[model samples]
Target: MFIEDIRNDFYNILLGNRVLLLVHYDVDAICACKILQGLFKCDNISYTLVPVGGISELKTAYEENNEEIKYVVLINCGGTIDLVDILQPDEEVVFFVLDSHKPTDICNVYSDGQVRLVYKDDEENIPNFDDIFRDEEDDENEESGSGREGLEALVERRRARKEWEERRHTLMFNYTQFSYYGKPSACVLIELSALASRLSQAALWAAAVAAEAHAALYVRSPARCLLDAEALHRYVAAARRHDDSTANRTACVVMEKDAWLPLYREWTLEAALSHAAMLAPKLKLYARSGSSRLRQLLADMGFPLQQARQAYRSMDVELRRSLLTALETAAPKHKLPVPTKATFILQRPHMSPLAALDAVYVIMALIEHETLPKAEGFQLALAALEVSGENEAWRKGSAAARRCLQAVASLVHATLSARKLLLAGPFSYFIVQDGTPEASVVRGPLWLGEAARWAAGGAARPLLASAATDPHTSILLGLPPRFEQEPRNLFGAAFEQAATKSGVTVSLDNVDTSVITLPTSQRAQFLDALTALLA
Candidate 1:
């Protein structure tokens, strides 16, 4: 069976107590172990690992540690019929039969009351045998030992116990080293090693998911295990292999449908490999049905692939293209058109072309709020506007031109209503812009360039420095052509008036207005005048 099936089976065993993980020391087994660990991390289960030497060690481990072993997860070992039988009466046994499948006879067993036999595909879905096994009368016989007299009760117990012991047993019994926990009888089944490794793996998987076709996979793990070096190395290797194969396969499939891969030659094979590796597991899952599968996965995961691609330019090639195609293919299958109300904020007052054009930054900001990952894009755009002094152009009570004021007000209202823009009472530090541009004459958001820069900085954390925390004087130099005898005097006047009223006491050197550009060299006198006014 595949990794998913094994993972799901392990999950069921984890429902019991004190689990042990046994695997060969080989790379495949190691990868399998790491993969198993990734799943456990999601559930906060714990585990102990036993390196495979022979069944002697496993039997010893089981015999000595059965008291602590609640569940046994065997990896890289085919069907462990004998091991399963030995561990069965004492504890719940679960083996992720990786790279090998055991004969069917060894696998049949009674669980939750009914006899269950797991086939390859059905491995993941544990049969809820509770109903099949428990009759109404047996349900009433709730007392543990109430069903039989001593001899008869013992026989019934033996029979029931014997039936339960065969659950995970496969033909490869005595030869393969098996995993069994010491304390199997208790309800404490968890393997910490397995759980932690699984968590790290899942995190890696999530990153891959985010990178691949802009799919986002959110994992909530019950326990927190910091993936150390060994765990990470194992994860990286498995992720790379998984991603490469999946990507290659998906790329082939997508290309067949006239869909292009999101990545290109510009990306180093290693880099592309890394990105694809993360999404590999899910890629096959979504890639099977062409575009429709991909789109559905995106919607189910609550991920906005289009927005994510725009935010991460490199993704435009593979994720954006493939996703759009998939969405288009799947669109027809739903039969009914999504209501305009559902798809967009329809029937709002129409803005003039110019008005809409000017509102791009505002709209983008609002989009960021409505989407997941909390819109790092919006934050950057807002920062840029604040830096450009465009934000300060409007005052709380000062009379400004009605048109500009209304545009800004509308932007704010739209963003606020969308739950994306955070207003910190009369503009504190970052004045977030929201509203899309509807007017061609208005062009793109005036603050877009700056916002883009800020967003870039966020992607390069630790190494990249952050923007200033304080607000500075903003000067908008609307220098007219040929009339630039010098506008420094006017700029100085605005700066002087705005700076003091804004209560900024930074050095003229520290002021941000000069950061974007030097006022026309001819405006030196004006600069001095402005300097004097601020001082």
Candidate 2:
């Protein structure tokens, strides 16, 4: 089908249906949801926003709330996985997917018309039905208005339509055209808003969403950083105009004037809510209303008190304030500052581990704003040590205020002890080849990034590091710039040769720049052999 045909169908489906938005728990997802909310509000359509994490949570949400939902709109997620298989066999739920993740086999089968996917390449390679019907009509009209002039006019019209279609596709945020990691999901919604002829009002919100997504993904994926920079710049400029126009609004007034507001622009209310959703399980905030907490915070920051209370009710303002104060207090102590640099290791033992990662970036932004050198950058890595199950498990326990402190202490201790294996340089590393049980506890990419950042004296550099649980399993983190040429093949051959020489079963498991898992019993010997080869 042609792009126009699909768009027309989308509009038809959305004409009178209630939208149930199942969005992911990230900046991109939040931004996408906000864009949709704006569009839905503009069209006078009723919608509900439900923030979800992965497939399981989405499934649970669907099962519980399938009755009243007319259109299930999935943003940022549900593209990579086969949702058709996941849904009930007799379910009649129609999904409108606005995602950029790589599609699964179920997405390719056009026969399943229930799922209307508005992605980058959904129109590519498919027959343009408009052109086909247009040609047929032109042939019929040739009998009555048959002349060279008429034929020429038809050809010209076709050319114009073709050009418009090409331009429309060009405007889409296609993953294949750039980094292939997927564009911000909000980009797709923004395009839809354009097709719906609401772009003028929706563009600013869309751009802000894109900017937030870019800021959030900057450190996590270098490729995404490069890909999103131009879009972010353009959108931020557009969003500034909107921001300026809304400067007098209560929300804006509170956000801009809040003394406790984090320095980062991306750490806005939407981003915080998204992070809270992800950290809910760990923070024990799931039982409490996150929206209420946000509103209460705004009220405390001088937003209209009555309005804040009306918007967010059924929660104690004092309890919410206490929670916020605890998080603020716990954030600074786990931040291990380097001696002579603006670098810190934000090891979170009490906070939601991954959610605390967002806090680390916010801290980096603060450091950058305050004390970073004129031309220099700052590095903030994170490490989360395993606290006792009773402390880490927030759901089954109480006295979270006390547990938070204990968790931070455990994280700080683990981070300090892990600093012993440091090998500092431009290509810094921390070799965890000590076959001790204590060393095995520190795992994951976050730990690796923290180790590398520490070894480099908090300097931002391409790092090559390795962490081993035992002699048989080791994970290599970060790819140094010098080893970019044929990294996979080079690492593969080197590891093979090292394994052969050391007479141990050594092999590279999914070797890539960010991470490379090596399975071998003689990890120390393997590292020595590879180091000798590189030297």
Candidate 3:
């Protein structure tokens, strides 16, 4: 019913308006954008696609283009954000949120017809429609009863109401639990396309895109499988019928098993190509401006301007294959493992973060497929060497990697030295004194990963490790094989109370895997307090 209501509004708003599509930089968001773009093209609507990373970028993009934009459709984001607070006081731009994230109090703040928030709520926890109607029928049929019977009926009704309230209070989005990948955002787009009579042409593409997003989660942590098997199978079958390719079939199979598979491996070539195809338009835009090495590579690989543009439109399998090959050839070569460890170094000068991450994907795929002996856990050190002065991005990335390595080393040494370490659930707790070399260079996530590996003597669960940065600040990091039920923020009331007792300040930087800042002077006291709380 909620979806149908939003669908009616969405169709109404699309009439005679130019559209601005703001999408997140992920597979799901990209797929949703493609689906909407296809629909817009069919309807002869002019639209612009803008890929944004965070709330700040979304705000900036809106401010710059709000004048020309009549309708803004946000995909995969903007649900949790308070849009009314972010938008200009008098801005009349219409917004349609197709997101699954938790929403803020926007409807109450902005009651105008300009904003429409479409999302899943606590519907699952609510009584079923049949049950509600049945209860109403029973109420109507009930006759005046004895005092005892009436009292019993009142008590039973109150008990049922309490149970419903408890369920409502505990309700959470299913996707957060990795139960299914058919998110409301994607489903809404599918339904919209069906209403327009384009489902036959567009459904498979949308499903494949959602499937790819679902599959991507497995690459990092198989223990936390994100795709529903039945849903994934159905999508994969649809993809096969739409355009059966070796890559498509391989992706479906790999996704089903919840295993680690490289995107560029022979079997997953299609998925890799799809990724390149999605990126081609963005690459082409960059190519038009200045001299880009990637553009040149595409040209050298026999893809001229016309051919490159065509690939963006159609995502031809052969073109995708060619592009994937060229990228692989141009990618930075992996170095030999460190003497006795599974650490490989890769350096490419002036590479963008996207390119660097792509390289990581490629390399990880290779390693996983190769299954090299003596590989306990693999560590990759990537650097974008600067030709000019100093590349700050590369410097920062390299420094973080170095810090991780140093932190791992310190952790291992401490473990061998029998330093006091406490284990609570998936957490391995220890503290570093302020101003120490180790404290200065230690990073939370990296430390947790390496420490967990050593502590477990094999594959490890998600872990949390903390270190004191200074007398008034402590850093916390969580390594993942995460579940939905895990506590988001590490420092809660108990930790705050401990901080207060020790005259420390506590601050959480993020929700998941938070970087907690607290007083360093009471490091031991804080650890003790945390231990007691955790215990």
Candidate 4:
């Protein structure tokens, strides 16, 4: 069911049809949706887009919008779950799914002509169809014969079918043992849409942010992130060659070595260093001496106290330019690893450059905005992705992102100070009390993840974090303590396995399996099961 030809088998097939586009509520999906919308506009393809949060919502959206639509395109969802069985669309309907969620449902992988996977990941070793399925020929043979010889053959066939079923179960469990993301869906669409053509800046930035979202969320491995960057090098090269001397200003994305700290460019030197994931743990920021250690490191880097305390933009030009080199030089003495990385920055004529990492944070924050309606937040997120002269959307999202990060840092400090982060067998965990200032902030998975990673001092074990959503229910998220080149998450599978044995009803309703919601009262029991499962 995997389509080899993106244009012919996927794009061309939807040229003149009315399509129902169901996009998941995530930064990557929003960026991918924006690119697909552009592609659809270019081809004059009629489509209705509905943002879905989970499986039930996806079904509802599809059923409501699929009245007259024969071609449906799903962004970032519906791949890991059985679509045809759940949606139950008419025979004429053909679904083209572009989900980055890995370990796609075997049913979807081998589905008949109705379900078509638009993108195929080379990393997935999907079992052969025959290995996982056997026809009902045994029943057919029994129906067609009754003689002793036929009866014996039928019994033999039944035994063979049972063995095949058992093998299939094992194969499926091994295949779906973990959940992770593949390449950004936006990157795939951009590549296939361009068809070896030069890269478009707007589309490229979207792709870059989408890729960074995977990294920022730890859903994609560092090695995979590098591969995502390699896929966009041509675009960066083209942007580098473009002339920005024209009257009309255009944004250009360029690669540069910068700090790994998110939103550092927009924050003051002291604040960025203090809250940064890499430096915070290394500096032991939760302890009383954390401040002196930070000042000492800055002093060692030769950054003046005044300059270090001021906004990054207000810092002296020479100091700003040499920041990376200074950090690299002083890092070894401070027991800090080199924190600089070659990353993308959006450059416009007179505007401050925006980091792709920052963009990911911005969009994610907007989408998870507490007060704003989801539809409005969705629009705001799309607008934020646009690198325009008057980037009001970007500014708004940036402000929200900053607040979110500050809350995460605050929560991490509070948790550590209160000695709430406790080890639970195979994982370490902390809970955000209901009325805490940052409890609302950490309720969203992205912010909670940020808090979790920061709180995981040495990242000694896989971390599980929970935030109270209500008196009866709480949301829990699991994360690996640390990952290197290959970040395979065992948490998703762990959550499900523990749920089965725990005898507690937990909801793994989110598209990302790492996140779940469970009864507040039964959380301790669920944790015990998880501990037992992981142990």
Candidate 5:
């Protein structure tokens, strides 16, 4: 059943119950899980939180922790698949799912009472229950009745049912043809909690980071992100009432116009402008004249060459304050997009205010860290998101994010220079060879997705990028085209079809349908099949 009133139907229902919270391993899910945990703690509701990476991990976590868990809550997972079919929970056990992935499985959407979904997206055209289901009593009666005329009626009824079934199949195919994010699940939870008068700083910050995650990954549209954050602005106003800037070093959450560069505050401004995905291509940083053009842009903005090269934090205070104005006045002449927008920031006394986008990269690096177990990474990410100072683990994750961005820029430049990106019938693709310099860095789906976008340039088509893990296997990441304003990826369904049609051995273990693992031996055949299907 779909939930319309979250405070009444979802929050109040779990007030006194022991809940099993299974969260997926991702940046947005981590933030959403933290928000829920804070809300649960305040109400004195006992719950066990487990982070699951895929369907198999989800099942194992549910079975091991479901001792007396009658109310189960899943975040960013278990929505695309049938819950009852997979979990087989007891009849009394109710599942509350808050997943951003779409389209939601028909079984869950049409479930009677045991399952409840906490998301509502305006774009999703869910099928009507009558269109997809039929009553069994009528069929039984049609079978049991006896007579010549009755026999003819039964045949007619069966024929009608078959026609309805065929139509239902077509409707389902169209609905689930693409996989995309709806909104940040954390922001949804925060909005509902505020309706119940249960808002907190931690929850607001978490929601902010989750919203930034969507924008950073390009999984959600920029307009949608701003629309969803409208509700969050009210909370920020209330939270920012009395605290002065230097009061005991208390952390303050503020919304203000800042540069769109990812980590310009933490990193040097020059590096950020050159390597950030939003600015790199716009500045034509790959060409030989790119550097001189950048210097000229800065000079025309009245910013000194030395100040532009220095770390943003160490740059003169007056010049730092003038950046947004300078860019607004001069960036357009250089054919660059607007470089400033109002974003959420976590500011502490006598330190740099951390932007939501900056926090997203750090948290994501922790969750997908090469050395840490996913469960441990989840813990580290949660701790890192606190208002307090960063621990050693947090610092390590920040360093990793910098390296990852450098590798992404490196791979994008190498691919463009070598002309390795290939254009096919309906899509474009680039491969990271087995022993390439930055091949290992782009192995993770998130990194590869960033690389694919960078290499896509101005082409209005999906880009598929693969990184070889070994001679036998490679990992694939799919992204929407550059011109797609809403950014719904078609490759999720296309990958499934191509794998089956090509007879390739592939693994679809991740909750993200756009990522897949297949043998290197059959890469060509799989591409041929995918091209045909997409065409």
Candidate 6:
């Protein structure tokens, strides 16, 4: 729905501009280009599409097409400066940008209004100045442990803190967290790492996408981006405390206008640049996930972290890798993983029976593949039953349990689907009959034979029957009514009823009426009975 909103916004913006959309050749970029083109068509706006061959070609195209193009809308391209320079000062150029940002100088020029522009990074909420330096306690601890304390004590404490930080960072740097927590940088990382320990990539991504759509509507704020120097410094210090010395391997590059601020010595742009250079190559390695922070958080939340991790991995790999790393280094380490995946679902095993059933159903639904054997089905069913035992609805009537049974059936269907075990046939239905001990003569397993007669016999009789007095006509019933008399009497009555209904004489001299009882435990009698009859 939000994507639709974005498409509409693009259409409205294209009305006045002579648009030239330049996009990369990759699938994501190409899709974005087509979307933009569709919008232009819908609005009856004129537009030309350009495929980016390379950086040089892009620059050449920008220069050649400069005057007539009022807006160069770049989708999924970032850090293009030459193209920016070629655009007219008054023209409105919007970059529905992703993947990266513009060269800082180009951004500065645009900010100064040399050209009217809108860029994606700006649309995404950048870190608020107010949000920076909120980690005062972290700063205080760093100062006290490293500077105010005795030298050996400080060194020991810092070393211990650093180890803790790295472990936290590694766990937090998970992709699932990127989209979870409304894609909050910190929360996403924390969650992803937690999940990674338990889930595979595909499962986490599945959940992340679902959560993303829901969170987009319910959660108003996008993840906060980091911008302030002081906040970044604290972030770095916190990161340094982590065990992974690789956290120390990154470099940050800062460019400045000399007159803007003076006497700034604490966090030099040179030091940041040095850090960024150190990290460039290793960043590629970090892109490959280990135990991510996002995974960890989901695990803590009680989502099967293994499945959550799988869902996370199903996304764009680069984004997954980058998001995890960003989140990993942002937060302080806690021994316990927090904010579980199960938190998203309201029920748990210990809750009401309905809740328990719900929890079991959700977990089964979340399973990545059909790795569990058929025996697991019984275990899951038992869990569902236990969960439902406390449900007042189940006590009042079997409605709650019946609903749960249907839910379990759905999960079984999904499992079969995943395994590619589906059979090609008409819709499959089941019939279950249960009766009290006092009604044993005409109830319980006895009713199953009658049900079979109704479904396999009586239902067929109507479609196959011929004219009255036709000797070749046959009689069928879905089920023969239970007669508490002699078997002969029961059979005779059934024949008489069929004859009266169809106005045909019916004969039962050589007709066969069979009955069979099934051996099934009380707990699974319904399911087993159905299986026996169907077989």
Error of 2 at 248 (Å): 9.0
Greater-lDDT candidate between 4 and 6? 4
Go through the candidates in order and give each one's C-alpha lDDT: 0.31, 0.43, 0.44, 0.84, 0.84, 0.30
Name every residue pair that clashes in candidate 5. none
Q: What is the lDDT of residue 223 in candidate 6?
A: 28
Per-model TM-score, in order, reads 0.24, 0.41, 0.45, 0.94, 0.93, 0.23
User: Candidate 2 residues 1-535, lDDT tens each?
Assistant: 1123535766557767887777754445555665666677788887766655456767877777777776788776666555677766245667877664443223433425666676654323333335222345644654454589868877876787677667546532231222122556666566666668675433433343344334333332434444543443444345446667876221110011111211112223322322331222222222346446444444443434443233222234663344344444443343411111111111223432222123333322222222333122111100001112122222211122122222322332343445543443333455654553334333434334333433333233444667674556776655433221211113334455556676666433321224456664565565666666656
Instruction: Give the residue spans of candidate 2 off by over 4 A.
Output: 1-7, 68-70, 89-92, 103-111, 121-180, 194-206, 219-535
**Clashing pairs for predicted structure model 2, backbone only:** 472-520
Decoy 1 TM-score against native: 0.24
lDDT of 1: 0.31
Report the lDDT tens digits of candidate 5 across residue range 190-303: 997788777777788899899888877778787887887788887888778745533434777788888888788777877777777777877766667878988888887888
Q: Candidate 4's residue-wise lDDT over 1-535, tens digit each?
A: 8988888899889988999999998988998998888788777989998999889899989878888789999999999888989988899999999999888988998888789998888778899898887676655665555789878877787788788889988888888887878888998988865873434777888888888787766777787788876778776775676644454367888888878777878888888888777778778877889889999999999998999888899899999989999999989999898888888888887877888888888887888776778788888899998877547777888888888878888888878878999988788899999988888787877788778877875464788899987778999998775653446778888899899998899898788888899999999999999988888
By TM-score rank, best first, the candidates go 4, 5, 3, 2, 1, 6
- Give the per-residue lDDT of model 6 (tens digit) for 479-523: 222211111112223333334444333332211221111222221
The numbered model that scores best in TM-score is 4
TM-score, model 3 to reference: 0.45
Look at candidate 4 and tell me the lDDT of residue 380: 88
The lDDT, on a scale of 0 to 1, for candidate 4 is 0.84
Give the count of colliding residue pairs in each prediction: 51, 1, 6, 0, 0, 73
